[model samples]
Target chain A: MIPAKFDYIKASSLGEALTLLQEHGDEAKILSGGHSLIPSMKLRLATPSVLIDIGGISEMNTITEEGDEIVIGANCTHHQIATSDLVREHVNILSQAALCIGDIQVRNRGTLGGSLAHADPASDYPATVLACEATIVAEGKDGKRTIGANDFFQALFLTALQDDEIITAIRFPKVSQGTYQKFFQSASRFAVVGVAAIKKGDGVQIGVTGVSGVPFRATAVENAYDGTSSAAKHAMDGVDDIISDHFADEEYRSHLARVYVKRALEAL
Target chain B: MNISITINGKLVTHDIEPRISLSHFLREHLDLTGTHIGCDTSGCGACTVTLDGQAVKSCTVLAVQADGSEVTTIEGMAQGDQMHPIQEAFREHHGLQCGFCTPGMVMTAADILKNNPNPTEEEIRHGLEGNFCRCTGYHNIVKSIQHAAEQMKA
Candidate 1:
């Protein structure tokens, strides 16, 4: 399927991409892996006049250790993250979540920054980032700013990024223990209900996605934790906007969230 | 827009629109029809190809996005008259029925075996989760890849 006719410019660096984004405003869209945007474009859901291809930005493709956190470039592919030994050692749940996203072909081309920027409610990284207390870094004409994962995702297909800004990297705190449990949609391999639980000292940080319009940290469940499985009961305590599709109804998704939360807690 | 891609070890340049997908570029521009387009939505793995040595759904990849990258389609798998080991195994083990999905299956199989030279039956099945085979119920397809792994190892 061909997308709508649009101008394409390959940005070799981050500064060029930012400038292009500023030049086009909302008419231009940043192209990363193009797994999501291209498909949307082909379906005519997104018809940008120009595509700023940032797939060649080498600076935004490195995985490094910055003090206490593991800094992952926004352009890092799912296959890179899923197979990275550094990610496997620290912030392992991110790796776990990365592996659960789509299939091998999709993983080879999809990017972390692109996925988070797209902010699909069923996306895997949102759950992991929220649960791990990761920070998302966005750069614009002014400078770079970090937004906590809690405030990054605004709504379905919406993020805290401005039209002129692009995600440069995601910073995740090193965690020794974490688990991501997901009930997948059979055809697309998207999460029907995905719950990520990270053990933090005496408490657990729980993030839930695919059950609601916005991926959120399950604070009620974390607050209710007392070293037992009973805390998983509050998985949906404060969540109101539940998604109901043919793959999973609201009630079924709610049930799966609690069940997966319990399973994640048990695994932790 | 103008883009140059090393497809099947041959550098091909084209002046095309940005919306043209790599699958269309390979089929129409280069006349390399071995890469089949079963599902344009990236659901079925019929359009799988190796972009810089990694298997990706060509339908999801724009022709412009693959500029300066090395892409290997199913047409590049064989050496002249000799079929690739994976193709030979598929023929020997009856891996295909209608053969519409063969090109994609072969390309994905090459990637699978490339990553894991000695993959178990379960591993082969997991690696092939992206590719679909309605015929053979994947019984013979799995057997073909399993046999291919052994042949490649030896």
Candidate 2:
């Protein structure tokens, strides 16, 4: 499947990427690992006139600590996140989710920033990020600003990113206990229904993905959680609009959401 | 656009379209047909290859994206007709059927062995999740990788 012809530029810096994006307006798409974008392009589902290849911007790839948060560069691949000692120590749930993203090949090339920016409803990171209350930083011609995970994901593949914006980094506070559980789609390896649950301070936080048009925090499930299966059974009490796919019907997806939530919460 | 990359330890550059996938570039332009392509959507890992020492699906990567990096395809595994140990193990264990998925399986297995010189059956299976083989039911593939691990360790 050949992607449509388009002009390509490898940005040497974040500034260059932003400038190219600003100049091209809505016609420019930023390329990170190309794991997500390239596949979409090959399908002809996306036809951007210009490809701003940001994969070469080495400065945007780092995992570090700042104050109380663990900062991860957007260009950091799933394999990096899955194997990073800092990520494993700081937020094990993120590593666990990264580990299960696809097979070894996918993990080696898929980028965290790209995954979050692409904002696929079936993607794994949004669930853990929403559960952990991570902050996403977006940089543009003006400056950089942070978006809460809950607000970052809008719907489907939609995000709050402006055409010129680029995700620079995502930061998460150190967490002691967290887990991601999912029923996977065999072929794409995407989640059929996934849950990320974390014990944060006095309460349990949970996020549900692949069962909605967007990945969302299941506050109802979090409040109903009592370390028991009954709480998970009632997880969908307040949530509406469960998604159905060829792989699983709505009823099954809802059921898996509750089942996985139970397993994740119980694991935590 | 123009890009340069090292494949099989040889440096090559070309003026190419931005849309050309790495799998196509390797097979068509470089004639390294040992790297196969199946389900270019990243589902089938038949196009697996080493990029900077990490296995990635060539179908999911652009030739332009691989610029300035080192790539290792199945063709690069052997030296002067001496098959790579993993290749030898595959033959000895009858690791392949139809042979469409061998190049990719071997590449991914190379990556697994590089990270974990000796892996348990479960680990080998886990590492092979991306590389699908519709034949052999994966029993012999696992055995082949197990044998390769022992041979590499020896």
Candidate 3:
């Protein structure tokens, strides 16, 4: 099916992209790798007046190492991240999660930032990033501001980013070890229950996906781990309050969450 | 926009709408109908093509995005009048029945072989996860890929 007609602007630099966003306001949508946005446009779920293609912005496509964090440019494709030597050495969980996203074709075109910005509850990256306690950098008329992963994802298909802002990069703190475990729905490859666990010096963080409107942390499981109880069972215990629906009932998703959390913790 | 791309070893330029999908560009614009579009949603993998030496779903990519890239379609896989080893193996092993998914299946298999010259049966199955066949002929497809791998190695 053909998408609705809209003006296309290929921005060569970040400044040009941001200016276009400011001018178009909510009527503009930024296109990165076009893995997420293009499909939505084709389906008519999104009909923006202007499409600002930012894939050519070279500055937004690099993966760099800062003091104690790894900064991944928003436009970095999943294929690039999954095969990066730096990611493999420093943050393997992201690479592991990237490998499981859709299939090879989707991985070649999907970008890390687009996935996070799209804020799909079933996506694998949000939970992994939340578990790693990453920060998102958003650039707009107000300049730059960083939002924690937990604060970044506000609701289903929603983010803390303003309509006129563009996500520039994401920063992940260096962790000793981390792993992501996902149970994908067969056809769409969306997570039925995805878990990401990170081992920081003396603490562990657990993030659960495909079980709620937005990816959330399993605080009870973390608390249980701190108290020397079984982390997975405790995480499952906290599932009573989580929202549920047709894709996966509360009971089944809870059970899968426990199973995945245990597996992720074990792998970590 | 007038976009120029090297497709299947041929340099072609087309002025088309930005919304035109690469799959449509190859099939409708260039008349290289070997690349089929099974599902416009990018699920079927029937529109797979090598964009800049990397396999991507053509349905998901815009023609403008591939302007500066080299694309290898199923039409480009064969040499002169001879079939590629994968194609020959498929024919020998009866990898296709209806032939609807043949081009994409061959292209995806070629990509896997390019990366892994010797893939186990399970590896071949996992590599073809993106491509689907309604005839349930995956068993023979695996054999054909294995046979082609051996032929290429020889």
Candidate 4:
């Protein structure tokens, strides 16, 4: 099936892309790798009037280390992050999650920024990022501002990013150890139930995906495990309100969440 | 819009609509029909190609987004009349039956082998989570990739 007609403009720089977005506002969509947007466009689910291709901006494709955090440009492909030495060293769980995103092809073309901006509830990186407590940097006509991972994903396919704002980069703090486990749906390969756990000092932050509108922390489980190993065992005692529709129902996902949370905690 | 790209080691330029996918640009514009378009949605990997040395679903990529990039398709995998090792292994191991998903499967496997020279059988299965083959039940495809990995390592 062919997509609806649209105008395409390849912007060479961020300023140029921002100007295009400011001009078109919600009517204009930024095309990075187009792994998520183009497919939706082909299905007529998202038909924008103008597509500003920001893929040519070299600055948006970099992965760098800044002091205590790793700053990844929004355009960095899953392949880039999965194979980067720095990411493997400091945040290996992110790389592990990146490697499990899709098939070889999807990882090569899909960008971290694009995935985060799309904010799919089942996306792998969102839970990993949320577990790592990453920060999303957004730029627009009003300049740049940072949003915490907790507040970044607002709803399903929704983000705190303004209509004219573009996600510039995502910054992740260094952690001692982290692990991501995903139960992928057979057909789409999205996370039917994914758990990302990070060991920070004396506590653990557990992020759950594919069971909610947005990737959210399993605070009930966190509170349970606050200072004991029994926390891992009894993590899913009170998180019944988080699960939703998809490949698995609330009961099954809750069960998987309990299993994965225990496994993730044991691994850490 | 006018876009110039390096496809399968050759430089080609074309005028395309903003909505024209890279898969269509290759099949329709350049006539490189080896890259099959199985699903218009990105769920299927039948339109897989190597973009800048990494496998990507061409159906999900816009031609304009591929500007200044290098693309390699199944047609570029072989040299002259010789089939690529992965293609040869697929034929020997009976990796395909209907052949509709062969090209994309081979390309996706080739990309996986390039990254993981010694992938485990489990890794091979997990790596191919994106590309689906309705035929063969994936037993022989796994064997084909395992054989190709050994051959490539040799």
Residue range A1-268, candidate 2, lDDT tens digits: 9999899999999999999999999999999888778888988989998999888888889999887789999999999999999999988899999998988998988899999999888999999999999999999987999998889998788998888799999999888999899888987789998898899776799888889888888888777766665678766776777788789988988888888988887787
lDDT of each: 0.92, 0.90, 0.88, 0.86
lDDT of 3 by residue, A17-103 (tens): 999999998888999888878888899999987889898888999998998888999999998899888888898999999989988
True contacts kept of each: 0.75, 0.98, 0.55, 0.94
Candidate 3 clashing pairs, residues 3+ apart or interchain: none
TM-score of the A chain in candidate 2: the value is: 0.97
A53-99 per-residue lDDT for model 1 (tens digits): 99999999999998889999999999899999999999899999998
* Per-residue accuracy of model 2 over B59-120 as CA lDDT, tens digit each: 98899989989999999999988999999999999999999999999999999999999899
Candidate 3, residue A148: the lDDT equals 92
Native-referenced Cα lDDT, model 2: 0.90
Report how far residue A1 has shifted in candidate 4, in Å: 1.5
Using DockQ as the measure, the top candidate is 2
Per-structure clash totals for the candidates: 0, 0, 0, 1
Q: How would the docking of model 1 be graded?
A: high
Q: Give the per-residue Cα lDDT of candidate 3 at A239.
A: 51
Per-prediction interface RMSD in Å = 0.8, 0.8, 1.0, 1.1
Instruction: Indicate the residue-level lDDT of A140 in model 2.
Output: 91
Clashing pairs in 2: none
TM-score of each: 0.99, 0.98, 0.95, 0.94
lDDT per residue for candidate 1 within B31-119, as digits (tens), equals 98988898798888999999999999999999999999999999898899999999999999999999888888888888889989999
Please state the error at residue B132 of candidate 3 in Å: 0.9
By DockQ, the better pick of 2 and 3 is 2
Question: lDDT tens string, model 4, B74-142?
Answer: 999999899999999999999998888888889889888988999999999888877888774599999
Report the interface RMSD that candidate 3 achieves against the true structure, in angstroms: 1.0
